[model samples]
Target: MINVFQPSLGEAEAAAVAEVFASNWTGRGPRTAAFEAEFAAHLGVPAEQLLFTNSCTSGLFLAVELLELGPGDEVVLPSVSFVAAANAVAAAGARPVFCDSDERTLNPTVAHVEAALTDRTRAVLVLHYGGRPGDIAGIAALCRERGLTLVEDAACAVASAVGETACGTFGDLASWSFDSMKTLVTGDGGALYVRDPELARRARQLAYYGLETASSLDAAGHSDRWWEPRVGGFGRRIVGNDVTAAIGSVQLRRLPDFVARRRELTELYDRLLAGVAGVRTPPTLPAGHRDSYYFYWVQLDPAIRDGVAADLLAADIYTTFRYPALHRVPIYGAGELTLPGAEAAADRTLLLPLHQGLTDAQAHTVVEALAGAVAGRAGAAPAGE
Candidate 1:
């Protein structure tokens, strides 16, 4: 069976993990600090601006929490994104205002976001879906003019540049993921990056049970030899352990290679499926935005989409349904959203296997199966009566 997603981890990762195990300090110590420093440097930001967390979901939630948004406030986001985007806003005690995406790109347009904004809107969460930049500059401009904070959920996109600038560097704050299936994986890890010093300080404090590490201790009037947290924030530390950080550091070093390999596979798919029947490949971004292929999605013409997924499944190729429009989900436990474009993509978007492990042969096999599925379905339709 050909799997849709497989992480590329081998002796190098094992060696790093072994080293961490050998060391006695395995909790948010030297290794974690090192990983943070390296990750920040990769983003071209100062080291102090980044904070690591257990998952991208946690980073998103923490970012919203620090913003002090609550019940009366709202955060605007596209319904086409992973549910984590919606959940994070809800976790912050704020509402998520769902918007539509341009059908071709699968990302929320600036106009769509502006339409969703209301007096209560406090922030906008933009996702770099499938490793493509989602109009970062335009969205940033809109957010600035509207007095709204921009929080980038760049979990699927890392090291992707937009007009010579990286995606993660555009927003006021951003959350990144290192899930096993992502372009850069650490089994499970995440980070938060902030451009403001005060916010960075507060985020650092929040991550570690609101304790002031040595830095905060030095500021206090310590007459005693031993130092402690100046003010009680919660002694429970949210800091990640060293074992995962060590693994993450190694993954960080190999990220460029991973991106390159995935791009190679995507270009191959583009060549094969360029004008295939009943298929629409994910659209290309403007010239300034580059892609990092975390997922390679295609749209099936409705006439044959239903059979497309089952056919791929029968052929032992794994496929996924990215997301239904958030407003349409029963998470509201209610009826439906009024978004037409998002609803259309939600029903038709199909993900093709595109991971670092995918070979030239595997890419061809999936494309062949897809072509057959679409043709078979189109051929089987009932004749006009």
Candidate 2:
């Protein structure tokens, strides 16, 4: 069976973990700190700006929590995004206002965000869906003009960039993922990058039990009080441990190669599927931007999408829909808000296998299966009465 997603871990990762096991210091220790530094360096950002977490969800939650939002405050986000973006806003006691995506790109534009803005709106969460960078520069300008915070959900965008600048650096705060299926697999972990020093300090304390670490203690005072622990704020055990960090450091070294392989596979898929009837490939990215290709998505006629997915499953080739429209979800409430683009995308988009481990033959097989499925569905269509 061909998997839609898989992590590329090998002897290097195993050796890293083995070393961690041998060290006997596997909690939030030197290895974790080293990973944070290396990750920031990869993005060309300062080490002080990054805070490692247990998952991207936790990083996002910390971003919202730092804003100190409450029931009266609101955060606007696209309905087509992963539910975690909405969940983070809700977790911070802020209402998540749903917005529409641009049908071509499957990401929200500045106009869609503007339309959702209310006086109570405090922030805008922008997700780089499928590792494709959205209009982040434009969105950042709008956020600045409106006095709103910008939090980037860069979970799928490890090395993705708009022009020469990276995606995560544009927003005021950003969250990155390194879960089992993400571009950088740390087994299960994430990181938060914040522009504000106070926010970074708060996030670091929050990751632990609100207690100052030994380094922080030295900075505060070196007197007799140095031996005593200080609890400065409310917190939780959300920090990523050294064991996972060790693995992540090794993965980090190989990210450029991983991204390159995925891009090559995506190009093959595009070449194979071009001009196939009733099939719409993902929009070509604008010049100066690059996608990490976390999932190579294509849109099929909504009527036959389900059948095509089933056909692929029967062929032992796995596929999936990226996400459902968040506003239509029950827990987010059955709001009257209408997002035509989001609804349209939810009904038609399908994710094909595009991971580091996928070979040229596997990609060809996937495209062939899809073409056959589309043809079968076309032939079975009812004639006009």
Cα RMSD to native, each candidate?
Answer: 2.5, 2.0
Return the top candidate by TM-score.
2
lDDT of 2 by residue, 45-116 (tens): 889889889999998888888899889899999998898999988877789999999876788999999999
Residue-level error in angstroms, candidate 1, position 142:
0.6
Model 1 regions more than 4 Å off = 214-236, 333-336, 383-385
Report lDDT (CA) for all predictions: 0.83, 0.89
lDDT at position 117, candidate 2: 97
Task: Give one digit per residue, the lDDT tens place, for model 1 in 39-93.
Answer: 9988888889898788888788878878888988889898888889898888767
Query: Distance from true position, residue 210, model 2, in Å?
Result: 1.2
Counting clashing residue pairs in each candidate, in order, gives: 1, 0
Poorest 10 consecutive residues of model 2 by lDDT? 214-223
- Using all chains and alpha carbons, the TM-scores for the candidates as numbered come to 0.94, 0.96
lDDT score, candidate 1, position 49: 87
